[model samples]
Target: MTDSIVRVAGLTKKFGAFTAIDDVSFTVERNKIYGLLGRNGAGKTTLMQLLTGQQFATSGTLEVFGASPVENARVLQSLCFIKESQKYPDSFRPDHVLASAPWFFAHWDAAFAARLVDDFRLPLNRPIKKLSRGQLSAVGVIVELASRAPLTFFDEPYLGLDAVARQIFYDRLLEDYAEHPRTIILSTHLIDEVSNLLEHVLVIDEGRILIDQDAEQLRGSASTVVGKKTDVDAFVAGRDIISRTGIGGLASVTVAGLSAAERAAARATGLELSPVSLQQLIVQRTTSDTAESETVTTTDAWSARS
Candidate 1:
């Protein structure tokens, strides 16, 4: 891996006596896109706040480009944080935000921002407070993309964007990323939407790392097999099953790993196999511990075996 653009060791964040981020340590390599995933209240935001120096770490160290980022102008100037509810001064208009970008971003692209405004159909004259949620989100997208920060943190950048605008944002982001690769940390609940764009995923559940792996490896690590209930059970009897479900004589089993031998064996049993997607994996990993997950038990998921 290239030198880490972001490094956190024993990073901790406390709110009064409650600890939000608990000694989280990780390295984000330069020029890579990382998916920061978790459900609500998973400390994903806290981690981002620390990395971007929005808030101080209670304990441990945080380094962006090999130096303490807290109050460090050199580091802060190269970073852009797109927040969920990006606030603006009351009555401030979209044009005002654009006018101020040059002061904050060293390489601010005025032409790109103007194009985005046109594409997003933002009314430059309208006050930020008067704009709809979707328009507000579009404003942040414009700034973040046009700013071209070396380390960009997109925290739920599409909070209220509709499908069409969201697609536009994704398309533009990918196009720009290809031409100008940088370290990006995207935190969002819309896992399935950006699953393909994520090179790596770090999943935190209730403030703990639930899953961390390359997207490709994660895709291959599990598979769902369906067939006669008995045949399916027999085929999965000795293998590691992540989850399963069944109705009557038909059964669907999600298992880990499928070697050539296993695939051949499953085919002989007339079992249908399909790859488990990243979204499915995240769902299985995060929701299994809940009491309601028992409803999924009769379907015969091997997640318990994990």
Candidate 2:
């Protein structure tokens, strides 16, 4: 079995009365791409900061590569964290950043970095402060892909890039990852775009982990059952329904944990079973009417039946 590269148990971080991360726990396996997904202000960035040792936890433990990452150069050396709002000295040019990268990343690929620079069309001589937002993002992407760090964290690395540029970044990342396997945690809001690239997914909602599971397993975990009102209601009875909708005499319900026999039974009843997109599932799981209420509430009727 592959070893766990990152482990967290009961990790929590607070600021004054506000908790940024609340009793979160999960493990990241080696050489896999994980999507750290959530809505805005959902503590995704805070959690990434904790994992990378940029911020300390208020309570509980965090282990990266079997050791605490805090003030440990050895642990930090194996990581490359690229954030959306990365900053550089006003006087420094794009070439200066590339020149300094080799000193930090032991496995820096100068040739690959050069190629990426050309591909992104970054102006090496222009001062970084004067570059467009997209160009700055390109600089970060180039360094991250060329660094070949054992574990990399990209927190919305494609923030300012257009569709074409984003595709370039994704293509390059996939190509490099294929050749050199490494652990990657990508925290982004673009769920559907990167859905296929993820092996696992970690979703945070209101400073808590709402979902942590294999990507493929999650894809099949929830489905929408649609048909006549009576048929759909009967088929989804005693099932965990996350959301429901109706039009005229028909009803569609989003449900979880349906087995083959159960699905076959639904099909037998003339109900249409449609796959739920990852984005749709997540949005449903995180939406709530009250701030205190947890997202994705199961049906009380289903519980009683079970």
Candidate 3:
């Protein structure tokens, strides 16, 4: 609802005979950190490419900064895209990249970049190609944070980073973002790690937008109930079940949208209530979708044979 920095409508992208990004539509509001989440080969990268003008969409409209992003200088100027596999010139060093960053990013901060370099312990004089994978990822993280672009996309930016280094990236990101508010889209497999940093979440499954909701709302949207199999099943009879598993007479069920009374009733009935994390919820949802799709395909094949 707030002023959106990116507006997409019926967007689709394909490669020869394969569709990468299916018809997806969503809005990315300004000054918020969004988690672009999904499994591998789920079109998260393709969607980002389309938004950043790295690849043309096969169909539908995508607007960045209220205009077409493809070759639009005005829109491109305010964007910075950092990725795990980012390449640099063979002759370039950390210092050289830092020196040239200002030319590309109007809001580049040299002082901040220097601080980040120290934080990540990057060697300024060493050739980029010689740096270790963690060090290389650090360089990209430094540029992304220092760029201060109005719209930034980080696609798997911490591939080779250690836990400590990844924490540093998160800390620096939060600190810098507080001082300089900007819209950031983070794409990564480390869902639980950055779950706290996200304000909104956009989950894509099989090239389609699956979940678009506020992080806080999603946090409390579902609860896991564990009890006797029959009792648990009865309690969740009409509820939107995200997932359900049973062992002998005991059953554990994850249901969506339980009211205060419902929770109290479950507790009174000796059913244990537990919170469901965002990562768990998404996994369950996507897995359920996949299973359903497979089932439908099998059914169609069987009907044809019959």
Candidate 4:
């Protein structure tokens, strides 16, 4: 049986002339990591805000923890949202923020937070306003991890952290989650970096849910075929084509899943099949038609390789 902690139906958020999160709906299960992915201005942030009750929805229904999240202390208590530009008190220091986290998060882990502070090399005494962009981001990362909320939202949480610091966050998150499982929703532009960490993915494009599926399933859901233009056309005739490009006699086409027999058939026909990465697949799925227009053809594709 599926355990859904969050449920939304026909949810929509509009801002006068613009529709930020247009009619969208999906479910979030317990004890899993979800990636809310999309291109810039695709309404990723807007959706997160609506879920966290930072903004009221223009229409539709959404429930968190079996109740509306808007101004509900009970529901809000179980959520910790960490964003890139997370603000702090004017005079607050890294130590101050960590010191006060427990007041807001019932499950806040001081010891774990301290360990993360050291791991990120965050200065305790320095005022937040004086910290570098990376150091500031670390402060938020520390709190979100240590909060241990039942449902945590990390919205571009590692904005300025260097590669090493980011890795530390990922490693610690996975390690801690193993010991204390909880539902986590992560929204970021670094798809490839967090791709492996994601168990499930919810891709938003143009304020609508574009792709919702298991990360593992998405890994081998698409394949690119390369060979002669005429041969490629014949092979992918009725198949879902994602994007296609050609020069002279050579052509490259991406298409949806193909059965083992189909793959063998393509190989026999002298066609080269390559697996599409999660990032590449989402890019192909959400890439604007104007941009893909330069590629030559259209349809859409997914690979059956696991």
Candidate 5:
């Protein structure tokens, strides 16, 4: 097998006259956690749909598990896609979903699924229609984690989960992945919370990929510098400033790509520079109108900013 389990070359998805994912391409390696990050309507969901074979791509080549996945039972059987607003039948109950999961997944772990239900305090007999938003989200996480699909896509898996419950979910995920490694693509906006768990990150902006890099590499790409407003502005004048703020004589400016020389210079100048966080970098790099702007970045500067 190739190093990548899923590969998309020039992938595009259009909804009528407008495109939801454009010219996007990437390779997902096995046994690594990938963060599919972007603002709302930035095509994150659309891209996941394409990768899971839930929707057809309008153009370009797509391969999952080294073969075309369109209506292929062998390939579809190995994929698990738990969506944020996942819909169940009107009369469906949480127990019903659990009961039927094993029929579709070859590696379904009933014991693990039951443990997750108890861990999340989910009511198996509760009607899905009557479940709270948070409870509904919990069920999706349970199913995705227990399914043990070779390639899993979690689209906003922890929507209404509280901080404690979310942490528990993360803990369980890492523990299980450690034992049975596979490809997991998690799409979420809670960047900092899950940043440490991701091995790789893909930042989508307005239907296009803005950044594709190792999570560790991103930690050094940008930094925030604080100092006198004049000094801050002067130091930032010739560089690419991702964001800037000031109050009276003091200023804080976030800049992209601070090399060793620049870091040393900042230290000498008494400018306190802190590494920019993954969340802050993501929010700053994505366009404000990303939901419907169709304004994908045409350059590499956005990746640097992110």
Candidate 6:
């Protein structure tokens, strides 16, 4: 079994009367990429902060590298957290940020950092405060990738990046990770884009863990069944239905925990079956009731076009 790099039990973080992270518990394994997924205000950032020692949990135990990360130099040294809204000194230039990175990360690679600077076309001499949003994001990506820390947390690192730049980041990350394996937790809203790169997924909704499982297993855990309304309803009866839509005499319902045999049986009954994308499944699971109702209306409209 892979070693657990980070562990939490009954972790909770609250601000006044509001609970940002409510009694969360999970283990992050070594040498795997984990996707920290959630909608806005879902406490994904708060959880990252707790794990990285930037914030103290209100209750429960938290451990990183087998010790409390709070003020622990050894545990802090193994961490590299890059945030979407990262801030740097007003007087600092891009080159200054790159130059100072070595002090924090013992495994920092100057050569790799320089290569990434060139790759992103970042102006090293330009003052960071004057750089555009995309350029600022590139700087963070460069540091996190070149740091090569044992445990890296990238919280929506591609906020202002364009399609090409985001692809570059993903490609470089995959390439480097293959050569130097480590634990990486990427928190992002771009679920489908990075779904293939994730080994494990942890979803947060309303300050709670809604889903935690292997990425491959999650993909196969839910399926969409479509056919005559009566037949589809029968197949989905008593099953865990995530969402459903229908138009005229036809219907489509996404159901969870349908085994391979169950899927084959649906096909045998002349019902069409399709796989649900990771993004679709997560959205359905985490969206609010009002948003889900809106989705159902939208789905019905789309089904009418078919």
TM-score of each: 0.92, 0.91, 0.91, 0.91, 0.91, 0.94
Who wins the lDDT comparison? Answer: 6
Give the Cα error of residue 154 in candidate 5, in Å. Answer: 0.6
Report clash pairs, candidate 6.
Answer: none
Q: RMSD to the native, candidate 6?
A: 3.0
- Which ten residues in a row are the worst by lDDT in model 1? 297-306
2 against 6, candidate with superior lDDT = 6
- Runs in model 2 deviating more than 4 A are 290-306
Compared with the true structure, all predictions reach lDDT values of 0.85, 0.89, 0.89, 0.90, 0.88, 0.91
* 32: Cα error in model 6, Å: 0.6
Report how far residue 184 has shifted in candidate 5, in Å: 0.8
Strongest candidate by TM-score: 6
| Candidate 1, residue 224: how far the Cα is off, in Å | 1.1
Model 1 stretches with alpha carbons more than 4 Å out: 291-306
Better of 2 and 5 by lDDT: 2
Worst 10 residues of 4 by lDDT: 297-306
Worst lDDT run of 10 residues, candidate 2, spans: 297-306
Per-prediction backbone clash count: 7, 0, 0, 11, 0, 0
Q: How many backbone clashes does candidate 3 have?
A: 0
Question: Quick one: ranking by lDDT, best first?
Answer: 6, 4, 3, 2, 5, 1
**True lDDT of residue 7, candidate 6:** 94
lDDT tens digits by residue: candidate 6, 1-306 = 688989999999999999999999999999999999998889999999999999999999999999999999999999999777888888999999999999999999999999888889999999999999999999999999999999999989888887788888999999999999989999997787898999999999878999999999999999999999999998899999988889999999999988878989999999999988788888888777778777546444634532
Task: For model 1, state the Cα shift of residue 66 in Å.
Answer: 0.4
Question: Which scores better on lDDT, 1 or 4?
Answer: 4
State the lDDT at 4 in candidate 6: 99
Q: Between the candidate structures 1 and 6, which one is better when assessed by TM-score? A: 6
Per-residue alpha-carbon lDDT of candidate 2 for residues 1-306, written as tens digits (9 for 90 to 100):
579989999999998899999999999999999999998899988998899899999999999998999988999999998777887887999999999999999989999999998888899999989999989999988989999999988888888877788888889899999999999999997787788899999999889999999999999999999999999988888889988989999999999978999889889989999998787788778787673234333323322422
Better of 1 and 4 by TM-score: 1
